[model samples]
Target: MEKKPFFQGLTKKTIALALAVILWAFTNFELDVERDVRIPLHLSGLPEDLIIVNNAPENVDLSLRGARNLLSSFAFSNKSIPVDLQKTERGVLKIDLKRAASQIVPRGIDIVAARPSKLSLNIDMLVTKRFKVKPVLGEPDSGYEISKKLKIVPQFVKVKGPASQLGKLESIETAKIKLEGEKAEFTAPVQLQLPSQYMEVLEGDHVNVTVYIKEIILSKEFRDVDIVPRNFGELEYTTTPELKATLVFNGPYKTINDLTSNDVKVFIDGAEMGESRVKRLRVKVQYPNSDLLKLTKTSPTSVRVRVKPPPPEESPET
Candidate 1:
């Protein structure tokens, strides 16, 4: 009785320690703790032909309550709440967050509340359209002009976006490419201007633009070109000073250099001066390939012409 076995004492102490641990665990499990956690909001079951045009919530604020011990060891990483839209149509969709909280929260945690009880989403039908790519270029250097039409590789782009927005879009423009003080032909890689955050160029985001520039040459002048009368009926017409003028025109070097007075016709319309003896008429210029040349100047813009009835035909052998 006076001396106890060492092994017996050790056994009793172990039992007591075991009991204490069990009691501590029981108490901790009964106590509740609250925590506010941020969980990512995931979208699911969206139709392939639909898109969300409006900004949707990225994360949800969740208030969770659970046993103290469970709360202490809880991890919030990679947890998400999903909003299903499989059967949702194009319109404003209101989602009840409370209903979805149970599906995402950890097993032991209870959802106390969600900051936003409801979420509103704006959905639209997705569509694709072809849009012409327009190059945005700054003014070229002085005395220079764009000689030929700009050439864009992949002139058209396929764009995808919400149907409502895509319907209004006709063309996409490239970012401003500065041609100020630029001369000669050059190419540049430029990004397309996006219509909105919801719209994207499905083909590509960038394009290569080839610009053709040429120095503006001085206009070539053809002097002493004869002016003729046209649309004359049974009348004779004559102009003062024999109706001659100088013509000035600008065009490609080859085209303008090869042009001659015979290639151009300066005329006055006789029909426009009906029954008038003396009339002032405007001079008009014409050429076989008129589109190639730009008329810059003309001397004697108007001509004074005298119109008279043709002399009575001489009676033959009465």
Candidate 2:
């Protein structure tokens, strides 16, 4: 049998198909398409002791012109523009985005424009400082008081932040531990309160706080405490119905048990009388242990005071 020519088996349809494929490739490769790509801006080569203090753009819109096929391949892929700050000083520094983009982009792709042509970076030295942790507490229930100081585990924490901002910080506070209506010993874990966004707790962020609450002893009721005159050396002053008051106070059990009527002084100020014949005055309580004792109630908050002039002076003239 005679060998058929090499082109004898080639079909017209196959030739047309090959030509179409070649034409498609030529068009896609030679023609250019415009596309907008969002690329991330990566900061690198920064020392461990330095941080960016200002808000900088993390991503930039890059307008690129390239072949359609090439552009489509980078649709979902992110291109990074690296910013080197290894040799930079601590201050505001400007980076040229155009120059950075040119170095990273492939040869076929042209960077038409960047939305933000320049990036402004504010750098600061990071500093680690110690701060005392203060526990925040709320008011306890009535007749109850915090008997002991709030105890916190790891009373202090190390914080890192911009040196300028951290210099003024002396102490850090914990999240509020509510003691409202709390009457017993309580313990809880609380988070540290950071002063600013630039500040961070380098050590443990949480602390354990213990609170001690104690109930006050039963209040003592003293009947008929004598009311003394105040600032009445020359003027004789008298209160109607023999001024007396019932006093109720609360304190430690031993303190309240030892308290006597003589330990409390109830009086009305003479200066408050003015010239009125019948003047209403507020009753004030004075005690040696006023700081430790809490006055709960007074029978009559105010009293009617009457001022009188001595009438026996006329006998000296005779």
Candidate 3:
């Protein structure tokens, strides 16, 4: 009986040893390293879409926790299986639990939790477009009109969002100013919108828009626009006094360009301009400033002012 008991004990020990060895082998067989890796998968080159969301998806959150080894071997794809479009409607997007490609797929992972589980994807057909963000002005003070150069900053911007949503956005407008004859720098915080839908402005939203107004000079009437003379003294000529000079003046276009030979009256110290031949002056009219209407012309060239006294009275009746 003692011997039988001994044999039974041996069998029990063998069973226990075998169980321990099997457990040890299993424990040491594989690397038990797990990691939360972000993997990207292709969205099956279905058409190009540019729809951005205000929030992140849930499945995207859940798929992050995965085994490092498996994730390392996963493939990255921008395109994948065609998503289920049957239930897809405007402002709705449902993530394909199975179809969507991911960079990492855990070898033996059970999805603990999924975000946007059935992503009610507001299926926005995405589109990126370039637009001109121009400024609009309100009625200016009486007699003062707005200029074309009054454009806003960020002259151009890129817009992105659902196709239907983006298509509706035609133009963006800023605050209006009642320009009251002043050089003022104006700024405003503005919002963007479409015909009926709102815009997800990718580049611009609240920007510092500026408006500048130039004061116009209406009461500044012009006169004959005198010709300031040149002083050359103590130089004598044999036959006649030669006073060669150039004339420069600034005035209105009509008065300058319309100047004919009859308009010019030249005389030395207010004399009858004896033998003074008035050459046809060439006038070049120019707008002096971006603000004022003060035009100036340097002439086609310098006007040669010659002073030759009366031709010796022709030696009459000798």
Which candidate leads the pack in lDDT? Answer: 1
lDDT of 1 by residue, 1-318 (tens): 566676668978999999999999886786577889888888999999999888877888988888877877766776788888899899989888977867866678898898788888889999999999999989988667898999898899999999999898779999998988777999989999987999988977999999999877656899999888788766776778668888899886557777888889998888889678998899999975677788988888988878766678888996
Could you tell me the lDDT of residue 305 within candidate 2? Answer: 75
Worst 10-residue lDDT window, candidate 3: 234-243
Ranking by TM-score: 2, 1, 3
**In model 3, where do residues sit more than 4 Å from their true spots?**
1-16, 25-46, 49-91, 96-109, 126-132, 136-161, 173-211, 214-318
Query: What shift in Å separates residue 262 of candidate 2 from its native position after superposition?
Result: 25
Candidate 1 achieves a global lDDT of 0.85
Per-residue lDDT of 136-208 in model 2, one digit per residue for the tens?
Answer: 8877776678888888998989999999888887799998888887878988999998978888887778999
The regions of model 1 sitting more than 4 angstroms off are 1-27, 73-75, 106-108, 217-318
The C-alpha TM-scores of every prediction are 0.59, 0.60, 0.33
* Clash number for each model: 0, 0, 22
In angstroms, the error of model 3 at 215 is: 6.2
